[model samples]
Target: MSAEHTASAPAGPLWRLALGRSLGRSRKFLWFLLINILPLYVASDLLVTSGALAKISGFLEPVMSLWGLPPEAAAVLLAGMLVNLYAATAVAAPLALSWQQVSVLGLILGIAHSLIMEAVVVRQLTRRYHALTLLRIVLGLGAGWLLALVLC
Candidate 1:
């Protein structure tokens, strides 16, 4: 009876532990990063060059001012989303943005970036929209607002 119950039970610690070990292997992690990094970089460059970056900047610039950001901050924000943190930093650094603006950008990026891919990834993981996606946007904007208030 005990053996039957054990066999029928769902996978336990051993399965989880093995999975964790496999994931922890550096080769797998490196391969995963290698697979993704190039596409993200190329797409980020194209987005910036194709004027999408300018358009997004135009939209966000006004809203960002409330957070004490400059108009050009839109570039940084969009770059961060399209590329990653490093690319955004490169764009923003040349602007020599105020401390408040930097903080705000940090807050916004923390909540969401690479949004399209992320949405798909989230859907795959949860098998349902948990509505947290909306929360991410709100939190990003609110966080920027709060950070601006605190810093400025």
Candidate 2:
């Protein structure tokens, strides 16, 4: 048997401990999604229904235009940057984005998503958290811009 399997303590207790932690983490993820993402999604629907999304899109259109994205894409990018992919995806679901637009967003958000939360972990790991986070945002958007130029 392997050394790990032959530890002094039997495997059953270790397995149970791992399982318990896994379940705990899973529950936490579900709860977080429910409380955070669900409300954003409902708000998105409300914005759409109330015709407020147009105003929002118009206001953000200038920044989004940099990547050939529609103003509505600002919500997706903002959600990804401030929160996480789950929030971004929820915001994006109602938008009828083209394949090119989706690809560009996927490329950008993949690198730079979850900035505020991730910065804490980055700060823990490195002293240059500010530079690193800024670099990721620049690189992600730069790459997305190049891709959008090519695709469009």
**Best candidate (score: TM-score):** 2
**Model 2 lDDT tens row, 49-106:** 6878868688888888888888988888999999899999888877778898999999
Write candidate 1's Cα lDDT for 31-58 as tens digits.
6556765555566567656866567667
Error of 1 at 84 (Å): 2.3
Error of 2 at 95 (Å): 1.2
| Candidate 1 clash pair list | none
TM-scores, each model vs. reference: 0.56, 0.82
Query: Candidate 1 — worst ten consecutive residues by lDDT sum?
Result: 1-10
Clashing pairs in 2: none
Candidate closest to the true structure, highest lDDT: 2
lDDT assessment of candidate 1: 0.70
